[model samples]
Target: MTNRKIVSPSDMAFSYMGRIDFSKPDSPLFIYAGSMVSTKFTGTSVGMMIFPHLIYKVTWIGVIVDGIQYKFDLNHSDTPVYIPIIDGLDEGEHTVTIYKRTAGSHHYFNFCGLMIDENAEVRPENHEYDMNIEVYGDSVSSGEVVEAVNYCEHTDPAHISQFDNSWFAYSLQLARKLNARINCNAQGGISLINGAGYFDNYIGMETVYKQMGYEPHFELTEWDFSRYTPDYVIIALGQNDANPDPKRIYEKEYREKWKSVYKNMVLDLNEKYGGKARFIVITTVLMHEPTWDDALDEIVNELAMDNVKRFKFRRNGAATPGHPRIPEQTEMADELFGFITGWES
Candidate 1:
């Protein structure tokens, strides 16, 4: 491993994996690499830290840690990438890369700079994939936009009052903090299960993830999970499930069925990855009623076990009238960040 080769479509490089090309006004919000080494090998537990580069104008940005992805606000005009050198990575050498779904163009840009603890005692560099982070839910997770003129376009609507890269929603904020490479399977108007039940011709969670681009690279499903099994899965669903009408279609039998559906989904994922990873099931930010929180809690508590530790049910407080605004999402992220890394607020 003497000859180190670095490739960049953009002329940017650095040493010690610390900071590089960060001086650019509108540079990629995150840059780094990750390893699957165990904490025993390195004295630190690995994680990613994000600094918004702009004076708080980076509306969107993300990073892939191990394999489980995380996102954060692109608000700050400038900030540096923070990849925690943790001790849970497997004993070996792994490559960690960061990704950005450019806010305006909606294009995916993948880059690398961060590296895991190389100073560890047992330097076993032979693992293919280290970790995987999967985000599942409705619109927000799917990279959806309710106000955009078309489905293909992504824009913060005019009605949005509080606009700050730092004020961006919580999902993106937490993603950056975790330094996780992510697959955002959320779509606006989506639900715990298939949103098709709500919107006659709406996109579904699994379908969206499946339909993601694979032009030069193979789809996520086609990729080998052996390189890395999804270590963290954050399911932020149930926003649309808060329909006031008990007679709504997704209600009635759907309520009872949702628990089973959600439980089975987690079980299936656990089964797929051999129960070696972790799952975090989240409730809505602000639903129609508080009872929905109670129901979601019941489902997660009843179903999650073993490697899958369920965090307490979370809900955002009040915000602007129309939708779940950025402020609300920030509050939600505050809670979620604490849960994921066990970090104090």
Candidate 2:
């Protein structure tokens, strides 16, 4: 049978708890948070029309069909690329879900639509969740280099592209445990004040947080805060701000500036979303910077926002050369889950 069937975005169920531009229904924008597409279909093959960004784009997406995971690279493609989902499945109803495994800094993808076996019958499935969460941070939150077997295995950019799995990240893991939809606004080497030393000319999280997409080349689509409100907002930052060296430990001025920026960020978020969501600020897991921890405490106390709280991840051995691996990510997720549940109870 000819596999020439095409399905519109409207025909498939989409569950993304982030800001998406659906102005053009034909090409829905997918940013952070694992945007999911689910449909029950009778087909032997399935495909997707994906438009990747041209620069600063490195997206790792996973297509889960019937519980199996398949990862793909959606980056640097100017035109829409036709991605093969899978072939040779039994002729019956099957479910498929496509989720972003990379963070927002890598950029976003424009999902044009889907194509399947010409004879198959496809219909949307309801995959919505009752609760919503959002996570904002740097590499640790993005699940960067999480799959590296050992420190020696993490060498260069290629390794990051291969091992990074946002699906396994702490934010997503916690969301899954709570049965909540998540929005992940994280990048590999991002900070709030200064850019992480790893990347040259890197933009900080505070600056990029307002823009629609990560890369500068992409058309600016200012995020519409009204799109999806989260019940919980987890801020996993400070590591990048500390970057190559712990500025909070050695530089008093830098420490004060960090505190100021964090205070402003929290206040801004509280002002815009305070009425709807509770805020949880977190410290880095790689390094134990007491000054940074103190700074976070000060921010919370200064804000005195009844809904805001603070948490810290106990330092763990590096998962890779400089990033957290699967085990560390799992621990972080567990800690977060316990904290959130404890508060809710």
Against the reference, the lDDT scores of all candidates come to 0.44, 0.72
Instruction: Write the residue-wise lDDT of candidate 1 on 100-217 in tens digits.
Output: 3332112222333233343533222233343347666654443333223222122345632122122134555565566654444444455555544353244344433333332222
State candidate 2's TM-score. 0.87
Q: Write the per-residue lDDT of candidate 2 for residues 1-345, one digit (tens) a residue.
A: 264777787664544345566877888877764555567777778878888763444556778898899987776777888888888898888888777666655657777777888877777666667688888887778777777746532543455366778777887788888888877787777777755434336677777677666654456567777676789998877766656676444677876777787777777776777477899988656654566677788888888877999887655323334566677778889988898899999
- Cα RMSD for candidate 1? 12.5
On the 0 to 100 scale, the lDDT of residue 278 in model 1 is: 79
TM-scores, each model vs. reference: 0.50, 0.87
Candidate 2, superposed: residue stretches over 4 Å from native? 54-60, 73-76, 104-107, 151-160, 194-200, 248-250, 316-321
Q: Poorest 10 consecutive residues of model 2 by lDDT? A: 151-160
Best by TM-score: 2
